[model samples]
Target: MVDGAGSIGGELSPVLEVGKSLAAPIWRQFMYLYNYSTNFKRLEKEVKKLKNTRDEVQHKVIAAQRNVEEIKQNVKDWLTDVEKTITEAEQLIQEKANNPQCFKRLCINYKQNKKAFKLKREGIDPLLQKEKEFDQVSFPTIPQDIWLRSSEDYLAFESRTSMVKNVWDALNDENVYMIGVYGMAGLGKTTLVQEAGRKAEKDNLFEDIVFVEVTQNLDIEKVQTKIVEKLSIKFSNETERANKLYERLRSGKKILLILDNIWEDIDLKTIVIPSKMDRGGCKLMFTTRNLDILEKMGSTNNFQLGVLEEEESWNLFRKMAGDVIQTHELNSLPNDVCKECGGLPIIISTIAKALKNKSHPSDWKVALRELRAPSPTKFMGFLEKEYMKMAFKL
Candidate 1:
């Protein structure tokens, strides 16, 4: 009797183990039906929290941009992950409208409902933690300035490419004190210099770079502030700002200064800009529409950029305007328009983009008329082109 009882007890234990294992999957199957609405509500609430975090971070991003600081990679990564998580969770919510409940059909998909539960723990929670861990949104470094990023690489011609190389080589030349890139307006002077400056910094040619565009209305204080700011220094009163800038440059760091769009000369005495004689590691580069201005600045190496060749101009224009201008009806008119731009990249591109929408021959004639009818604000300010960029889209 005892032996028979032991045998029955052993069989009962395995049967209980089997029953316990089956109960879990059965509960899991019903969980979506029972908790589907609850999980969705929780996920929605979590997403809202995530969005609030994103909003706060976005403000930081804007401030970083305004201050000309680089946004931290981790912060950028977290933001991307948050956006993806919210999108997936929201998609799951939208899918629930036609989805069969977990208990309604034997073969029903629980993936969508399960994601709602999984996302809170898997996606939203991690982002919330990441947000809490962030102490700052940006890091400070001398980044390549505007033109390097915003302008397209049009170093197609060997001439422009050689100019860029010569300029970079000039910076390395020990005897070279101040370098100037001289050309008429819209000749990509700013673009070329900025790219060279970027390469110099990347190759560790310069310890730091400060780039500031000194527009027509030059504010001495504003110029000083911009230079100081790029070096991660605060500009207080004018005297204090100049002193700080001068001292920083005098610190013997190989700092490259690029002053763009200088209409007239700025006094180094007032700004306390140290020369290479004082600090051999420091260098100055400027761009001006007039070669005379470069000469006045005492540029040791003045490089002049020529207008793009006829072929280059058409290629640039076509790239912007597309085949609409290349159609059968508009063959010579396109060439005529390219000639009107006079090999200036800015003019060619702006005219092409503005004319891209206006495929009619009459529209081309109107553009030609505007090009021929000279406006005082046409070249230097690009006022006409600026207007075209906005007007055409309307």
Candidate 2:
């Protein structure tokens, strides 16, 4: 009985040791789960607060976005209203201008007939007052916003407009003091710069805008004279002119100096124009047919003007052709002529002007033939004759 009791006790001892090990791990797992649950309960209030704040912020953003859209719509409506009013006023003025003879007769009759004079006064007084008011309306107070003199045959196209925008943006950048616009001859480089100058002036970007033409021959004296003349400054001594010009430019106000049709590099210092790095607010803009000229002049930014796209070329051609193009019999001929123009504004405008009064399809065909096989001597002779005709008409 003693031996059996010993064997049973030895087996029961190993079972008791295993039970102790399992009990210790179970107690540790229970404590870990208890701590994790406590932490989650503690964070619950903060998580709720964060979600509420997020919702409030989202609502505010939506409200702000709505307000912005409302303001944009209001501004758009205002601009539309102003544009409509201006159009109506312009039409009225044009009508009055067109019937000047009728208005003169009415005025003379009003002087002789008392009853008619009273009725005329009633009918015309308001219009006259409105006309006077329109005239008196202050023109935009832009300083020296002059369109640089150029050939009136210039046409605007998308590519040219995009280049202008790029130049404008570059000029707005404080780092860009000198900008160069280069293109092939007769590609409307002069007109592009002129438009940019006009826009900059209207935007009040500069205090003074001066345009000077620098032909193939760079005449320093002539350029200086023109600039000083535009500034209303006089300096008699040739040597002191540079100093005078520099001082004038340095005198507080920003100046935009446009040099058109440069054929070669120009030393800005020689002409008394401030260099790109010298002046604070003064800016220099020049156009050349050669990109290398811009590099020589130390241009901070340069833009190359390209020809008009086919659609833009066609639109400009049709506008220039005017009533002559309305004849359906001349279909495809006008398009062919425009295509032959090779998107050159000068050629297109000159040809269009020459054909402005003619409606015959044969006349266009003849013009197209000449354009297709233009003889230098013959074209020059034709242009001279046209110029004389235009001069006589003027």
Candidate 3:
């Protein structure tokens, strides 16, 4: 009889343990439900307030007079998280009110409710802080006199002047955004663009004009640094530099970004120029020696810079060569020397400067002969072709 009673007790022990486990969860659920019921009104009030705050933020984001695209996106993500938490809390409240019998279900609902409350508490402060930041943020002002101009005189011939004028007109046109100026090296592409920038500044066509030189061996960091310096914005962290640049430039202001000397196709976004030009009224004007690069950049207008005409080339040479060519005997010699330069302004300017101080006609003759020699690679190919032509003609 004692063994039978002991076996019966052992059999009941498992059942008792299960009952104990179930009782604890039941009690915990009861307490959790009581507390939740007591706080439900307050929680509802807080969530309502949070929702109203979110709505206000949304309205401010939409109605604000400045560009807040980055901040707005951040706010959007935060609100989405908050909304998910709110939905979870609502579902947990509904489950608890139904008095679920499963211990596991109650335990899960309780933990989830606690987590929801914690999330709401943790999220609200940052949301409010960001709201304050948004309130205080002042939109960026338009940049002025940001165009970099050379100290030397920009001589614009008839054709070159027409090109410059066309560029200026395109830059101002609301429809025309990107302008490309392409030509052989040393046809005065840089000088012509510089002149256009100066005129645009004087006319106030854009709020800001940023000039950066993107060379053949592109250094992205250097380009970003130059733009940062022009914008006068301080930042740390090289990894985030591109993002910072985008934020600064994305503000709603008409910006003219002049990228000089683009050799190949470069992703503008990598250099912090927004891939899409829709940010504010931002426009891009780049100079390249190849037309294909302009096409790659999606240029809306292209201007090919031609070499100076024979008469124009002589005039530029005489101006650069100064008083040496004014002598009666050297007059015809200067014209002959300018002819050999093949109307390339760089060669004409360089040779004219070399002959500036020399007075003798013999020196002029010697320089003309040197100009006709096969030039090194750095010299214009057109000059080489011209030399070959003259040699064949002779």
Q: Provide the clashing-pair count of each candidate structure.
A: 0, 0, 1
Per lDDT, the best of the predicted structures is: 1
Alpha-carbon RMSD, each predicted model = 11.9, 32.6, 20.1
Ranked by lDDT, the better of candidates 1 and 3 is: 1
Runs of candidate 1 exceeding 4 Å displacement: 1-150, 377-394
Estimate candidate 3's RMSD in Å.
20.1
> TM-score of model 2 relative to the true fold?
0.58
TM-score list, all predictions: 0.61, 0.58, 0.57
Q: What is the C-alpha lDDT profile of model 2 across 1-394, one tens digit per residue?
A: 1121122434534433444366776643433332322322323333344335434434544565554422234333433443444354344434434543243344322222222223223433333333323221222222343464333555657667777789889878877888998877656677777877877777888888898888776889999988888887767787677688888887757888888888889878788877656785788888888899989878859999877788988888888888888888888888898898788665666677777887888888877777777555433434445534432111
Best by TM-score: 1
Single out the weakest 10-residue window by summed lDDT for candidate 2: 133-142
Query: lDDT of all predictions, in order shown?
Result: 0.75, 0.63, 0.69
* Model 2 regions lying over 4 Å from their true place: 1-156, 384-394
At residue 368, what lDDT does model 3 achieve? 72
Q: Could you give the candidate ranking by lDDT, starting with the highest? A: 1, 3, 2
> Candidate 1 lDDT, tens digit per residue, 1-394?
1121122434534433344355777656555544566677788899888899899999999999899899999989998998899898888877876674555354445677688888998899988997888999998656555544544644556547777778878989967879998887667677677778767767888888888888788788788778888888776687778888888887877888888888897777666788656765778999887888877767769899889988888888888888797577776888898898888776776778777877788878777777777675343233355555533111
